[model samples]
Target: MKILKLEKGKLDLFASVVQQFGEVHAPTEHEGKFSFKRLNSWSEARLDYNRTVLPPRKYFLPPRETLFKYREATGYVPATEDLEKRVVLFGVHACDIHALNILDEVFGKGYLDPYYLTRRKNITIIGIDCTPDEHCFCRSMRADFAETGFDLFLKDIGDHYLTFVGTARGDDMVIATGPLFSEVTHSDIVEYKRRSSQKCDTFKLDLEIRDLPEIFELEYQADIWEELGEKCLSCGNCSMVCPTCYCYDVADEVKLGSHDGDRVRLWDSCLFATHALVAGGENFRKTRSSRIKFRFYHKQRGFVAEYGRPSCVGCGRCIEACPVGINIVGVINRLRGVEHASTD
Candidate 1:
């Protein structure tokens, strides 16, 4: 992998150069939290953030989007090709990046999801190494840092970032920017590996991912779920904040007097009572306990069964976002019979 460094006062220039290729997006402060937003200046991008309120996955799979547009007289017509603009999603955390890869497997497998694919194809991913925060559990999920799927990867080395080239497209971007990076050496690679390894140990949460699915399977009917349901408000915050929760509902919205309207897809949460309800009014998961259990099992068990890996990256945003202080780690820990699972 090639290495590059942005000289002092050249980060904005670096961003500008990348912008010429496509719009540059990165984490920026919004309210009290960080968010992935369009970058107009280098200051707009904050690489030192622990996590964003929402994952960067929204860039590829929007929270809500139109699958297709149609007129009554013309019948169904394919959506316009308005997604040709390329994008540089900068400063994506490794956990979220890994989550995106999982999504790729889901959406790109079998019959391709044209909606997600079109947006994914026009974008380049640039990942930034993050120092784990108190809530981070990426190490537990083994996605603390990425080894693949990123065009460019950056690691902070005091005065400048040590950029790791991961793809030919990434190499071209670094070269085109010109003279920003020092040539990568054998020693630098060794140092980068050493530092990254050291950072992994910083995470307080550690678990054997190999045992996760089995643990979940064994705890499927466990009584801990009922206890969790008691504390859960069923507010749906956990699923909404999750990077891998891709459940959605599609509906057609029509104007008052016209048959012509728009077909839209909006985010849905399994925590909602009607999520699994059928036309005949049979609800598969009727109770809060069942819904909560289904949501967790879907991530830790069902998704692993379907995709060969758990959908959760252990980013821990759900733990932070929950108003009732629901910690998924605690729930998992309690299921595993860990002694110290309880946390207020």
Candidate 2:
């Protein structure tokens, strides 16, 4: 990996050079939290902010999209929205980047999802290393560090930002930034490693990943599901905030008394009562307890069985967004019979 160095004060200038390539989408304040938005100025984006309210996955797989447009007289037509320019998704956290990689595996496997792939192709991900907050547990998931997926990865080391060129896109970006970046020196390498070590020690949350498979399998009928289900409001906030939740439903949305319409796909949450309902009034996951178990098992067990890794990156946005204080780490800890699991 090639390394480059830029002083902290010159960050905006570096972003300006990147802006020449494409529109820059970076973290900015929405209300009380941060989110990715098209920036009018590089300074508007917050490199030091906590995790965004929603993951950056939205850029690749939007909340809603029209699969195809239909007209009674004309039949069916594909409807692919044109995003005019390639995008630079700047300052994405490591966990969000990891989540995006997980999505690539899901969508790019056999029958490639052209809709998501096109958007993914257009984005040049520039990841920024983050110091974990109390709510973050990415370390436990082995998602705190990323080796691929990002075009450029930045880690703060005192007055300078140490950057890693992960791909040709990253090399191009660095070249575009030009004289602003200098070659990394021995001292810079030393400082970068020192800072990275310090950053790893900052996370407070931990999970029992060793026994996760056995715990998940054995907990198929565990009493914890009942307790969690009762507390679950079915608000769907957890799924919405999650970086890796890709569940969705599709349908034709036609105008009243008109045949012209669009076949749209919308984000769907298993937490919804009617999510699993089908024709003949049959519902697979009708009970709240069953739904709760399904959601947890899918992330911890089912995903592992398929992907060789858990769907959860331990970003902990679910824990922060939950109105009832239900967290996956706490659940895993409790299942593993950790002494202070509940209190944690």
Model 1 lDDT vs. the true structure? 0.82
Model 2 Cα RMSD, 1 decimal = 1.4
For each candidate in the order shown, give its overall lDDT on alpha carbons.
Answer: 0.82, 0.87
> Distance from true position, residue 219, model 1, in Å?
1.8
lDDT of 1 at 8: 38
- The local lDDT score (0 to 100) that residue 304 gets in candidate 2 is 91
Pairs in clash, predicted candidate 1: 4-181, 5-180, 5-181
Q: TM-score of the candidate numbered 2?
A: 0.96
Query: Lowest summed-lDDT stretch of 10 residues in model 1?
Result: 335-344
lDDT of 2 by residue, 1-344 (tens): 89888888888888888986678999998677898999988768988888898898888778888889999889998876753358999999899999999999899898798888887888889999788888899999999999889999988888888988989988998998788888888988888888888887887888757769877888788889999889899889999999999999999898899979999989999999989999999999998888878899999999999999999998889999999898788888888888553335
* Pairs in steric clash, model 2: none
